[model samples]
Target: MGDGPDLIGRRLREVRAWRGLSLRATAELAGLSASYLSRIERGERPVERRSTVEALAGALRVAPTELTGRPVAPHTPGESEGHAAVEDLRGALRDIELDAVTPESTGGLRTLPELRHDVDRAAAASFACDYRCLGAVLPDLLPRVWAHAGRIDGARTLLIECLFHAFYLAKDLGYRDVGWSIAGHLHRAAEATDDPAWVAIADYMRAEAMVGAHARTRALEAVVRSADALTPDAGPAGQAYGMLRLSAALQSAATGAVDVVPDYLAEAADISRHTGDGNFGGQHFGPRNVAVWRVAMAVEVGEIDRVPELAEAVDVEALPLGRRAWFLMDVGRGLAAQRGRETVAVDTLRQAEELAPQLVHANPFVRETVADLLRRARRDAGGRELRGIAYRMGMGA
Candidate 1:
């Protein structure tokens, strides 16, 4: 959070200069005003939204990570170990991709119940935001699940779940390539089950994995199509359908389809009313979660003023630690974008970190926000707090 050379604004400036485009030219390309872009380049404003980052990256002809600084260097020993696990997972997934996941390859054939138990543990670790534990479990579990997926009932479903864990672990750690690979495996596994519900879930996960890839429109279309393919009713299918709608809402917001966001949100809200609070396939879909997604979409489009009211409608305590932490992170992001709200933003982010330190620390947006806050903080108690949060994020004081 100190005067880091790789801040988004600085990166943007560097890219623009290298592209030989004037500030106004780049602004027009990104659909932004010159003054706004100028302020951003000067570090007077923070790039707080993914949509903005995507737009700028598109204009600059660079990957979104080029600006967001993703796949960030590990800051602690635990983080380093978590990163190291990615390679092991990659190898396991590669074995599956190559059709090499035999009994011998997996070390031994495992019972369905045993594999299910391992998948459940991985899911639990994911919900708890225990990245180290999640990372440790998946590299060994995935190939084993694949070995049993052919002859055993429910083995494919378990395989899908393990792939879900792998996808999130890779994605959360900023390994988008690994996430995309896992998503492909997930889709194939879900299709093997011949269940439309599982297919829809995989589609949603694929769309999520597409985030920051500068494919916002395609991601939105995929999510909406999958959501529409499902019949809205009570139970797990309904819950999965509702999550798709929520994801669609977020995608719509990210792509600047402002009018469509409400429709998606409203549909998801109605679906949630029927599903109630349920964790179907690890997605905590309910009224509270729908409300949380509303806050997130609002934040995406820079509707900071509406975040508090939308957040008030959500009971975040009812969510898993991961979801709860994300909601708090979104609230912190919204607060950070508003003038005179630095102290509250730091406090909210601290709350998120308290709930899930690994998740909070690993988020590129949170780190960027903390850095921006530190740059603008007054030299007082608030500055000290900002520095503390920044330090925890591994942004340095």
Candidate 2:
């Protein structure tokens, strides 16, 4: 978050000038438009994707990390506060045993109605990838919901849904231990509730965590099992089924089963046609959501060129902020994969970062890509700027 935008731009311009290439020539080699590269070099914009930086490095005949200055050495200490916050949350979870929360100790707990409103707010914060906002609420929310869950008939299920969202937020913030812990708690909550749909939803969250963690085989298997477990009946169940199928297809795509993604998506589309799009109490299923996942699949399977076209067809602004940011990152990835598109890719990635710094910055996927770019970058201004980013990320420059 330091010096928000200018650092990468300076590095880009310096490298281009040092290479003794015209903007048009450099753009052509990098697969970026001349005008776009010109704007970037002139400090009119910033870069946010490692892929775009990689592309530029390729054009410049330098290592990707040379531009970013992120050394392969171990990072410096005391960087991100997220590490501390995650540890605090972990300790908090340990201190309060979910089983120990009884009905008798709910004297000062927030009412169910109030907690419901808080969950909605937390969900919105997650959609926006506002980790700071999410952190503020979850510490109190998690314990309160579990502490008073026994007294209310429907509260346990409601709280489980809240826990699902909390798990999702933690995963996005790169707090894997916290995320997995929350997932375990959620599964326990699902069991306690004794509801089929809730159980399926918990399974879905678990699968999602696997996929995010890059456990391709296990993720695909889990999604498939969950997809089958869901009954295609009316209401939220059908929506959950569709989402589960879509999730399976995405995992399939990741595993080079590109053909399976569309088929599964088609089936999901049929279900969503009737059930419509909306989070059926944290299911987050719908045609629109399917469309977003399609972009991701297309990128995953080497059909990088198709991503932007698909992304353009969808109204990304209409989606939730987190989803929108996620889509933009992929679009940038796709563009970076092609010739004459790196500049546009940079713009897309920057837009994504503006939408959600937590999703863009804290993501291991994103940071790894950035680190790779830095390692391959040349020893120049670009490399120095990249190193600055790496240093801030707790990785040495």
Candidate 3:
């Protein structure tokens, strides 16, 4: 476990930030005191309990397999850099097997054996920050991961877990074809695994991809199915259900479900509040999760007065720099919309558009928001900068 605690801590921090949960909020939800969790993040303390590790993994929306080091299977022609980093990982696997028959074996040995072969090829792509690889590998990876689902190994669970996130990134990167492909694979994987959590997560991903494609009615139905699939018995499945509900509500509003807009936004906010900060194992919904979407919805429905308050409640400083910049620009959009300040909107949206490309795997909504704002400003400018962004997104003005 040399540097194991530190590596785990770093991964935990990255996941938390990616999901947009603050330390205090995550602490409250994970049922660990904030100070202790802080120490864990700082690598001053190692997570010693299986329950603790599992809880943290859940919050992170990762399987316990990832926390303990294991070699995930490869999905490429060349050996990946990530695999090279764990030169000893395969040796570690053999050692685990030898120690398994010994009474003096540590718990880490048991965990690794179960997780070793369940490696996610998508993890490799994500680690490399190669969206092109992600697009190429992840589309094929999900089926390969699920192919072993019926096998008596931990890989099945780990693969599906990784698949959830891989698909999400695909959707974010505007690779909806890959995203939907992964989602469809998950549908089969969940059926084989008998895990409603998997089914719900897959369904949610499907809905999200549909939204990205602008198939509003299909997205709503996918989300509704996700919500219906969530049961109290589902555990993490239930949490995933909540994710779909929020996504559905937000998308519904985005697509002109005017009557449901306020209630859906309110419900989404309430769900975010009730779920606390650490519920997803490190993947909980917070302001950065649903609230970000809600604020966008608010803008769509002309809830101008609430925008400032909502913006205030969010930890804007903690968000990824690019997103924080976008949020600030969004605030400016709301203000400009209400006051009809075309110049203000133009300036604010310009700042956001400049920062947009910096945001890797950005949600389509961000582009759409900027598009709408620029389009409005274009009316005043008689169509100049707005056309530029439209060209970038391959839209006609």
For model 2, give the 10-residue run with minimal summed lDDT: 70-79
TM-score head-to-head 1 vs 3, winner: 1
* TM-scores for the candidates: 0.96, 0.71, 0.52
- The C-alpha lDDT values of all candidates are 0.84, 0.66, 0.53
Candidate with better lDDT, 2 vs 3: 2
Candidate 1 residue lDDT tens string, 80-129? 87888898988887777788888777778778888878898998888787
Q: Give the distance in Å from residue 268's predicted Cα in candidate 3 to where it truly belongs.
A: 3.5
Model 1: lDDT of residue 255 = 74
lDDT for each residue of candidate 2 in 1-397, tens digit (9 for 90 to 100):
2222344555667777888988899899877798878866654533544345656777888654455533212222321333444555675577566454443443365677876887778777766777667767776666777776777766787678678767866676555557778888888888787766777777777776653223656877877787787677667778778877887786676555677778988898888888877777565678787788778777766677688778877777678777788888777666656655544655676677678765666544445434444545568655665565555555455
Which digits, one per residue and each the tens of the lDDT, describe model 3 over residues 1-397? 3322154555667677877999888777666788988976775554433345556656666654455332222233332432332232223233433543232232222342434333445554453344444545443333344334444476566656656656545444444455566666556666667777666666766665553223656778777766775663324654665677776775666455667766655655565555544334223555465656555666655676787677667776566544455565566557555545545555655556555432311333333344444435545462566555544443344
Comparison by lDDT, 1 against 3, better one:
1
Question: After superposing candidate 3, which stretches have Cα over 4 Å from the reference?
Answer: 1-148, 211-215, 232-238, 279-283, 318-397
Ranking by TM-score: 1, 2, 3
| Model 1, runs deviating above 4 Å | 1-6, 212-214
Query: Model 2: C-alpha RMSD to truth?
Result: 10.4
